[model samples]
Target: MPPTPATAIAVDDLVVDRGGQPVLRSVSTRIAAGSVTGLLGPSGSGKTTFIRAVVGTQKVRSGTVEVLGHPAGSKPLRSRVAYVTQDASIYRDLSVKANVAYFAALYGRSRSEAMAAIERVGMGDHAHNLAGNLSGGQKTRTSLACALVIEPEVLVLDEPTVGLDPVIREELWDQFRALAKQGATLLVSSHVMDEADRCDRLLLLREGRFIADDTPADLRAATGTANLEAAFLHLIRELEKAN
Candidate 1:
């Protein structure tokens, strides 16, 4: 396997403001290669904001972001990390395979490689289906396959499993774990505690700051909670009172 990235993504004192209000304030985190790290938070809690910041789509009002051991803002460095958004980035008019191929072409990948990505996502059989005609789950899978076509060192996913059926969600989770094993660092933001538990490590984010960073087991044990959700609620409540 390719050597795991030393530091796939690093954010230091990252701050972002939208419409004069701070969405992410002094946030700092580091994601290592070959690990799946979950960023858990509630809606409107800056989870999406932080993800866009890391991916270089949104500008930081203060501080810095480093990806693949290089500073942010470098197109070459940005190309090494794949960012998957909740809304599947695909042309509805295009076929499933065509969507993947188009993105692969943007990354300069060959036809064979794009088809291989389609296979990896288990969508090779549906390659000819129009993207608009595919189910929600299929669209999600196709989007992920496009990301894989780039063979990025780091994958940043924002609510990647939202709106999918339980079975499809589980299937995608399995694939995500496989990607981690294959040496791709994954930083996924999710509000679903069950999905968060699937990660190797968890960063419990409440209002943009990390309230707890630990394995799901450790977090549950420390908080004496029944599950990650309960533990997260407990932590967030404590954090709110502390503030």
Candidate 2:
């Protein structure tokens, strides 16, 4: 028998409400360590809320979330997990190198470590450029560099490639794969079905609930579709018919 994959995250019967309205309804899933897992869903599909819960930021209505063997967001997991939001919280006035070094220092890392991270994200060429002066894609890379400086075991990114061009998007995806190969677990959220194939496993969500949790190949085979987008639509139709 194959050895069980080590779990990086586990969520059981997770429920969350925003302003008295339900956003996540009893969602449950597990993310394997050293793999890239995609969280796919449309707008208002609870993807952000779910991620927040895993990172221990979202208040839960009921359920449990464990990260790296500790309760989600516990003080012990602070340096073990890293989260990058859609709005890349970077200092616009600071140079790319300075920003990365500053964030690294926050986590007790050093200048050399920050420079290594900048190089890892392919942002070394722009290290001296001011963040506010870079292009949208470049800024995104800067944010990723900051995240890498921490060298966390788990990385949670929200819509990291939303507005990037094809070339930059491809490069970033390659970087994600490299990180996973190095034994880092990544949970990246995206509404774009095309990006689904890049992940080792996918958590398909809709209406604040998970519709499917499987690999891209498995999902495509199950739905008899040629692509993830078609497969997702097929699954939605099946759900509607069942209801």
Candidate 3:
């Protein structure tokens, strides 16, 4: 065989509970190398919970979650995947460069090449700035830099552009597109319909289950709508009426 088709991620009928109630019920999806997928929904819609379970932080009550072709929580698999949380996880007291270096060290990246990753995220200018002093967008970029320093094959980000300004949001999307061009798999969760439109596929979630899965264009075409926001609302309304 020349090579196997690599599966970046696979979640199959995964069920999770938060506070004694189901948060993800039989939700499943897959991501492959070089594609960008969007998990689009409102807050409290189980997007974060699903991502955490995929990354092995949250325990799956039932079913399976695989990352990098291995079961979630596997040591070898962990090394090949990156999880960027809604909250930018950074050390307020540490310099931007140092912060990236710190995370790199955990992943065993050499110090000499650590700055290159930071530069890739456009944070080289603020390398010496205390992470806490950076603007929200800068902090997000720093967090992204940290997550990517190890050069993961599968990248999962939760609300990466929440606090970013419009200009910065566009810039981040450009970076995301670039990463996809490099054959990295990206799963980003967001409530913004505009951002969701940029993804190759959209996984619309509500009340802990996937309501729709299709390209933004396909979704609109199927629903006879002009935009994702309206299409999403249409789906939700139809779902409610069926119950």
Candidate 4:
């Protein structure tokens, strides 16, 4: 028999509370190593909260989050994990290249890699432009480039393509697949259900709980729907009937 795939991230009975209200409810799931997993949910559905818990930045009320076999947010994992948050953080006074290169320098990464990441995000032309002069999508690309330059084993991105155009979005998705092919585990969150087909696995969330955890094909097959959005609607209806 072939060896089982390793778990890059494992969450067991994870429960997170904020402002004295429950966010996650005993959530348990395993994200396999070297694969792309999509976290799908709408706004206020706790997607960001779940991501924070995985990154070890958010305090959980119960359960545990393990990444790369160590506790989430451990010192050892810091160098191996990269998180590109929803908000693009960059020095407005610095050029795109400067911003990316600064982060690369922090990890001893060469300038070539920083440039390569910039090209990977289709921002090569804007490399010399100051971050303050860039558009929202450009800033987002710069932030993603900073994370990519590190070449971490696990990358957790929160709404990375929110402001990009269709061509840029498609290009970014292709890059994500390439990274997964190169043995990096990616957890990308998006509220756009059409993007579900691009992921190898999908974790559909609603009200802080997983409504579905399976591949896009399997989800469609099980729900008897034509597309993921339809399948999601079907599942919601089913849940409503069950209540």
Candidate with top TM-score is 4
Q: Of 1 and 2, which scores higher on lDDT?
A: 2
Instruction: Tell me which residue pairs clash in candidate 1.
Output: none
Distance from true location, Cα of 176 in model 2, Å: 1.2
State the C-alpha lDDT per candidate.
0.85, 0.91, 0.87, 0.93
Clashes of 4: 0
Which segments of candidate 2 are over 4 A away from where they belong?
1-5
Write the residue-wise lDDT of candidate 1 on 1-243 in tens digits.
122356677888899999998888898877777889998888988988888887888978998888776666577866788989888988999998889999999989988899999998788899999999998878988999889899887898989888888987887788889989999888898988889779988987777677887888899999999888889888877777997
lDDT of 4 at 115: 98
RMSD in order of candidates? 3.0, 2.4, 2.5, 2.2
Report the lDDT tens digits of candidate 2 across residue range 30-99.
8899999999999899999998898899999998999888889999999989988777779999999999
Q: On a 0 to 100 scale, what is the lDDT of residue 126 in model 2?
A: 93
Please tell me which model should have the higher lDDT, number 3 or number 4.
4
What tens digits encode model 4's per-residue C-alpha lDDT throughout 137-226?
999999999999999999999999997899999999999999999999999999998888999999999998999999999999999989
Pairs with backbone N, CA or C atoms under 3 Å apart (clashes), candidate 2:
none
Worst 10 residues of 4 by lDDT: 1-10
lDDT of 3 by residue, 101-220 (tens): 999999999776679888877788899999999998889889999988988888899999988878878878998888988999999999989898789889999999899989889999
- Rank by TM-score (best first): 4, 2, 3, 1
Which of candidates 1 and 4 is the stronger one according to TM-score?
A: 4
* TM values, all candidates: 0.92, 0.94, 0.94, 0.96
Best-performing candidate as measured by lDDT: 4
